[model samples]
Target: MAAYAGLAFLSFLWGSSFLLIKIASRAFDPFGFALARVGVAAAAMLMTSAVSGKVWPGSRPGLWVKLLALALIGQVIPFMLLAKAATLTTSAEMALMMGAQPIFVFVFGRFLGSSDRWTWLAALGLAIGFAGVGVAFWSPGAGGGAHAVLGRAFALAAGVFYGTGAIISGAATREIGAVRAVTASMTISTLVLGLIGLAFGRLPPPVTLLEIPLGPMLAMGALGVFNTALAYYVYFRLVHDEGPTFASLNNYIAPVIGVIAGAAALAEPVGPSAWVGLALVL
Candidate 1:
């Protein structure tokens, strides 16, 4: 029960992140925001891990490779994708697309030799959920435009990456423990994102902290502390306790929270179809 509650709260945290990212993106480009957010998250995790008496694992090439893969797929790639998508679509749309992550997790887990068998009930749920997505897309005033389609595609790609990440994190955490696994992954992600931002010439035309508004800076900090750092801790715990397929259920719950948050915080539109879709997803 405690695990379930933790997972639910984690979903809420992630749901609210869409709003934060939307606000923060006004100050930072996709690469820039991803770099800063993950960097802060890495620092926070390192500090917390030290305070918790969690020691880093000994260097192993294989372990480092796995950690790198987890960092790239889980944090770097998806976060950049979502950040860019936020500029083109409503938070509600991105959240709804992410809600489909469990289906992909189940599929990926099967390919990875997970013994969990798929039943008709799971299929029905997926069908219903996807049908909801289609309804949301079909609704008037729901779709943004060509850019919205592209944004939705990117969001779905992020969801696929997240599904893959969950499977990897489950295995990685088993070997290294959750804190170390997250710490290493976040560290690597921050480094990679920083390099990417530099390569894209983000630094030369840098937008300094003074230039950005206080609201966005605060949002970015909250995103690091609550959404990235604390959320990943809860996520690792859920994956360790319940398995990846179950932990991925947070994807299903988060969109409902996101729709509500988007409506309340950003005054983003929630059309009838979107509401119906959110209900089906829940």
Candidate 2:
């Protein structure tokens, strides 16, 4: 019950993250924003890990390789992609399209996830969820090449990456506790984002520092410390306890809150398709 409750709350926090990224991306380049967010998350994790006496993954060579892969798929690539996509897309569209996640997790989680099969109800729920995704994407609002489409595509791509990472994290969590797994993943993502940002000339420009507002900074700090770190920690525990099938339900719950938040906070339109999608999913 504790784990379930924690996972539910985790979804609520994470639901708003896409909007925060949209705000942060305005201040930093895509990779730069990704780098900064994950960088802050990593630094926070490092400090917490030190205080908590969690294993430093570098302490074990064998685990290090496994940790590295977890970082790449779980954090490094998808996060940057998400930030880039959010920069282009509307939050409502992004939220609505995320209704597809349960399908992604169900399909992927069945064959690829540690769990070999899912309950029929889970499958049916995911079918409804995918319908929602279609409605959200095909609505008149999503048809034209609006920035929302790019964002949707990016979010979709992130979903695929996120699914693959879920499978891997599902497996990896067996050996390492959730906190350690997230700590290692955040560190890897931070480093990978940093390198990519530098390689692509996407690093935060010098003006970025001066331009970052205190409000956004506070928001980012909350995101890095609470939303990203704490959310993942709770998620890892849920995944470890309940299996990925149950753990990834957060995706399903997230879109509703996300769309509402995007619409209310960002003044973005919730299109016909998005409405259609949300209805089907719920």
Candidate 3:
């Protein structure tokens, strides 16, 4: 129960993140924002690791493979992809896309998973959950947009990556503590993103000190450390105790809040299918 609660909380933090990011994107480009987000998160996690007396996870020579995968899929690549995808898509559509995470978890956890066996009911639950997402997004004017097919494809790809990240976390939990897993993931993610940014000619990141609003910066940083890093801490802890499936239930909650935030705060229009989809997903 503690684990489930933790995961749910993390989901809430992350779910509401889309609205925040959308607000922030006005001043910073998607790549720039994602770059900053991961870069800062990595640094924060390193500082946290040192203060908490935590060491990196895994001593085995082969463990780097999983760690690398986690950093790339969970943080670096998905961060960039999602940030870009969000800029092009509506929050309602993005929320619906995100609603697919739990099912992705089930797919990787049960059908493709090595450690756990899945129940048919679980499969049915996954289907119902995603079907709910479709219903929630189906509308007349804007039509719970699906990211222009290509953009939505990227979001789906991010979901797949996040799903695999959970599997990596599941594997890592056996060898490392929650703090260690999260810290290591963030640290490596930072480095990997830095390397990628450099390779793509973004070295030193152009360092244009934007005179952006303090509120947005604070919100972004808060989202980074609290939602991304700290949330992962909560998430990994849950995976260590309650199993990944239970821990992942938060995915549903997060996206719903994303849609609500976008609609209520941003005044973005939502179609009726979105509510139906939310009900089905819930």
> What's the lDDT for all of these models?
0.84, 0.75, 0.73
CA deviation > 4 Å runs, candidate 1: 115-118, 141-143, 204-207
lDDT per residue, candidate 2, 62-180, as tens digits? 67776778788777677777878877777667766666766777787657737746678768878978887887776666335767666778888887777667777877778788878
Q: List the residue pairs that clash in candidate 1.
A: none
lDDT at 196, model 1: 70
**Model 2 bad stretches (over 4 Å):** 58-62, 142-146, 198-202, 205-207
Best candidate (score: lDDT) = 1
Tell me which of candidates 1 and 3 scores higher on lDDT.
1
Model 3 lDDT at residue 38: 73
Could you tell me how far off, in angstroms, the CA of residue 80 lies in candidate 2 after the best superposition?
Answer: 1.5
Give me the runs in candidate 3 sitting further than 4 Å from their true place: 111-114, 136-151, 204-207
**Candidate 2 overall lDDT versus native:** 0.75
For 180-233, candidate 3 gives per-residue lDDT tens digits of 777777778767766776789864433454577877777678868887888888
What's the lDDT for residue 278 in model 1?
74
Global CA lDDT computed for model 3: 0.73
The lowest-lDDT stretch of 10 consecutive residues in candidate 2 is 139-148
Q: What is the lDDT of candidate 1?
A: 0.84
How many collisions between residues are there in candidate 2? 4
